[model samples]
Target: MPIGPQPHGRRGTVEEPYTPLNLRLVLAAFGLVVCVGLSILLFRMGWTVPGWLLAGWAVVALVDIVVIQFRRRARARAEGGDHSLFE
Candidate 1:
């Protein structure tokens, strides 16, 4: 049996709320810190390959943080509010 309401010719659409950007930014920042720290530890322990891999992931996390900051700033500007890093 079909669950819930059918498509019904696409007359009605449901919209889902999105995760807040600040939360995403915080998570990305945390990931970057952890990756960098672990990669450094791995390098000190002579695990070069894994260290490099973690370093690469750290870079990705840094990039995500930058993008999220930009988006957050834009959103704040659109909403006519002053946006700060700690906000």
Candidate 2:
């Protein structure tokens, strides 16, 4: 479906606006903070921490990359053509 309001023949509320890329960047940064916070909590508790912290960091990084990829794919699809060359 198109990303905006529906066609005139059919009506409902307008679609939600596309969020700015800065918002995604901020969310990614927040994810980093969460990973760090988890690591610190583990450390404070005197548990074996680095191993699990590293694992958590890796998962967050993977998720960040996935979010970026999802944005790229959605933008490309919205443009409706092979726009890779522009990249």
Candidate 3:
């Protein structure tokens, strides 16, 4: 397929392999796992304060992802309303 203006139609994006949103979600999930796992390991190894601190960082990343996705949607809605960009 040519990388022109419209790479896809209205529906059937989930079946597509290179969807941008899916890629972002995968990266975010990986980051969450790494942060949360490190936090658990620290807590188990007799580190109380640092473990909790690492957990807090993980929480921050989660919140950041939510906020960023929300803003992205809102901005897309405002700019000429091209819903196809989301899909």
Poorest 10 consecutive residues by lDDT, candidate 1: 1-10
Stretches of model 1 off by over 4 angstroms after superposition: 1-17, 82-87
List ranges where model 2 is wrong by over 4 Å: 1-47, 80-87
Ranking by TM-score: 1, 3, 2
Give candidate 3 regions above 4 Å deviation.
1-30, 79-87
Q: For candidate 1, lDDT tens digit of each residue in 32-63?
A: 99999999999999999999999999999999
On lDDT, the leading prediction is 1
* Weakest 10 consecutive residues of candidate 2 by summed lDDT: 2-11
User: What are the clashing pairs of model 2?
Assistant: none
Better of 1 and 2 by lDDT: 1
lDDT of 1 at 53: 100
lDDT of every predicted structure (CA atoms): 0.73, 0.57, 0.62
Query: What ordering of candidates by lDDT runs from best to worst?
Result: 1, 3, 2
Write candidate 2's Cα lDDT for 1-87 as tens digits: 333322334423456434443356566667777776777777777775684865588587668756765765666565544433223
For candidate 1, give the lDDT of residue 78. 52
